[model samples]
Target chain A: MTAPDPRLSINQATIKYAPLAEALHLTAGAGITSIGLWRDSVEAASLPEAARLLAGSGLRFSSLCRGGFFTVPEGPARRVAMDDNRRAIEETAQLAAAGAPGSAAVLVMVAGGIPQGSRDLVGARSMVEDALAELAPEAQAAGVRLALEPLHPMYASDRAVISTLGQALDLAAPFAPAVVGVVVDTFHVWWDPELTKQIARAGQEDRIASYQVCDWQTPLPADVLLARHYPGDGVIDFAAITADVQEAGYRGDIEVEIFNQEIWDTPPGTAIARTIEGFGSAVSPHLLQAGARR
Target chain B: MTAPDPRLSINQATIKYAPLAEALHLTAGAGITSIGLWRDSVEAASLPEAARLLAGSGLRFSSLCRGGFFTVPEGPARRVAMDDNRRAIEETAQLAAAGAPGSAAVLVMVAGGIPQGSRDLVGARSMVEDALAELAPEAQAAGVRLALEPLHPMYASDRAVISTLGQALDLAAPFAPAVVGVVVDTFHVWWDPELTKQIARAGQEDRIASYQVCDWQTPLPADVLLARHYPGDGVIDFAAITADVQEAGYRGDIEVEIFNQEIWDTPPGTAIARTIEGFGSAVSPHLLQAGARR
Candidate 1:
């Protein structure tokens, strides 16, 4: 068998139960070279300390957990959200400055959910677009790329209304290269019939900022917000998708982000180790094989 | 508020734990004029006895609970599965014979899951098509319309690989009028971005056999075979979709098909009553308003 791809990264959320320092050490020890940091963990550790820990662990930063909750209509709530996103960009820049040269990670964006009592999905999407336009210039000046993460349609109501890669790309289409792009999480998008087509479009436009992997389980709860499976444990055809991503010319970090009660309950070290192994066995085979053929 | 639509029907699978006869009785008692039946329950009671019960109740049979599992590869397995489907079609004909004249309920078709250990979704879909070709002539002769139910992508592995109304319509595209059509279940298809387009297409082709609704819960499970919510209980934009369906000229029965464990554990009578109430309050308003404006 061919050697596994070395660019594989583990998102801190995959081992969310662990402390940042512990998660960093565990991820690096698992042979993963990069890590995506969540804001909550960074806030808890303080950005400087989190940066110091990463520096000590010799882990590359893939992308920051999130920056955009841009769907709060035009009001104090919207202004407050924009202000917070700016802080997020600043924090991301700080992390980048503290890290090695050329190791800057994108600031992942989760365009906010529908405003309370709002049923207009189209309106909510427009709000996200407006927010992106407002924030793009600042993000560009900070030397940080904004990676819009398209959540699953199940989340369109209460989470990010930008629920498809195509939709995200459409919003990002007119933006400058440094201003906006997209983050593809397997858990959020594996079921889409247009997945391959959209990913190719993202690549053609040079809009792929990140790629994530997870699984969709069978017997999902009627409330989909609570349901998510670990990579390789659910029904997603990850191999097929990774092949498509590569074919689309998206050479980026493959980050694992699973939201599971079982993984959360486990110790951080054990979870990270298991995630790495699952990634190697289930995900790497396809990428490695594809690379060999090429 | 306007009066509830008398044409709406409730599929007994919506309250899966309810006994078949009781679900029918409760639906009728709630002023619902129609009901959909599951074949397994009918088989348990035997078709003659089930027909007798329905005839006694004076309720319109909206559709039979499915006939196609045509994806098992050729062999005794394939032959046996097709024979079973043929029997289901005959059972549907038997029910139609016992019901009111010109009241032939459609026989719903759930294209089978992937054959054991197989990963080719395209191949499985083709199997469904081939099976439909073989079964259509017999079903047509028996005066039964096969309503192909496009299950969600979550079921693509072990259930119906036909995961979208568009895909189902595409499969049924070449067939003669009313020989093959689609069952539009909101629970299975609410997440589709192209749902509105496909619904209009189904109406254009005059191929909508049935319409069903349920909610999608958050935190979806690893197994989605069992995950579903009651109407108005989750985040799907039901009012928008119902209006679209109405605009498309689909004057079919709106069947509620919630597959929730909570509803199942409740008494059948209570579940059916609550479903009727929810449907009236949550779905009827937009539809009634649309009708008035038209």
Candidate 2:
């Protein structure tokens, strides 16, 4: 049997109830060397305390949860969103510096959904483009990379208008790879017909900023945002997708980012155990082993 | 101001609870010359009775609701599904013969969801292709057209594996346009980034068997299938899509095929009136009028 992939990371969202310092300690005790952080969790724990805990524990922050909602249609609201994103960049830079050198502390960007009382998807997407032009320079100077996440089309109305990886890549095309890349979360993109080609394109462009894993289950909970399942619990072909990501040269942390209420209700240890187990069962076998494809 | 497009048709599903004979009288009474039928309602109303009513009511049977659930993995169940579809074709042909002589009595095909205990979307799609190949000859012989309908990606796992107009067009390519075509329902496809291009391709190929319209509303009802709103009630850009569909050369019935429970709860006359009003308000403006574009 192949060994557990050292690249495995547990996004804090997979066990949202676990306090950050406690989560860090628990993750380290459980022998996990990497983590993806959510801004609210970090702020709740206090950024300095979160930074110090990560620094002392040698944990890599795979990415910081979200910095884009640029669909405010300009004016004070848009400025506030841009300012909030700038602060997220500052936080990402600080965390990256605090972590072991060479770790990528990427800030995820969930391009906001359509503006209220509006149905103009094209216009909303353009807002994201304009915001990126304004924020890319700040991201580059701060040494923080922004990973534009293409949420599933179901969220097209309320979460993110960038609903396909190809579209995200097109938006990221005008910016440098170091400053603008994309997050490939399985839950949001597994059904995409263009997934394989776009993933390959992301690799070709060196813009695969983060690789997130979660399975998709049906009878999607009414609260769709929290409906993500742990890796092997749903129908996503993880081994196949993971193999493709590996072939695409994404040699980075594979973060499990589930948001299921049931999973959240579980004791943190049990939830973490289930996530690691599911990750091992669904993903570890696909990692390159002895130069032989599974 | 332009006259309401005479091509506008109301799918029986738009007023789901209305009795068949009453619905025909109501629709014809409202000056609608065409109506799409759902098989269950026909079967509930009895096929012979339905045929007799349409024969006397002077209402064109625009299309027949759904005859494909071909995603059952090969076995006895698959054979049963094919046989059921064959019966649906017979019914479609019978109803067509009973209506206006030139009405293209089309059967909408919703390729069923993933087979139980199966996560093989490709395999399911292949089953649909094979089923189509098996059934196309029968469809042509019966003088009934099979319209492959691509449901939204959210329904990919549970309702239909065919989730985009492009995939539906690809599937129909192997068969004659008269034997196999595609349904362009705005609710299922409005979110597709490639919608305009695919709609154009469908027109170029002469395979647009039906054009279905219903607005897409979010905070989707728990029963997602019933979440579709009447036109002008949600985020869809009806004028743009209707114009594109028209440009694509679809001069057939524009069917309002909603499935909302609230609408169903409304009185049949009230529901039909609302549907006509929404159709006129949302679609009538973009329609071609008397040899000139609106």
What RMSD, rounded to one decimal, does every model reach? 3.5, 2.2
Candidate 2: regions farther than 4 A off: A1-4, A290-294, B1-5
> What docking grade does candidate 1 earn?
acceptable
TM-score per prediction, in order, is 0.88, 0.95
What are the per-residue Cα lDDT tens digits for candidate 1 across B1-294?
A: 233467667787876765667766777777777777888888878888999988877877788888888898988989999999899889888887766543555898988776666555567778888898899999889888899998876576677888778888888987875788888888887756578889999889988888787776655544455567767776677888888788777776788877766678888777777777778777877675433534
Scored by DockQ, the top model is: 2
- Tens digits of lDDT, candidate 2, A164-202: 898899999999999999999999888776788889999
Candidate 2 docking: what grade?
medium
Clashes of 2: 0
Worst 10 residues of 1 chain B by lDDT: B285-294
lDDT of 2 by residue, B1-294 (tens): 223358878899988888899889988888888889999988988999999998888988899998888899788998999999999999999998898654667999999888877767777889999999999999999988999999988888878889889989999998999899999999988888788999999999999999999998778877777889989999988888888899998888889998999999999888888888888898888888746753
Q: TM-score for chain A of every candidate model?
A: 0.93, 0.96
Per-residue lDDT for A27-85 in model 1, tens only? 77766678888999988999889889888888778889889878887889888999999
The lDDT per prediction is 0.78, 0.87
Predicted structure 2: lDDT: 0.87
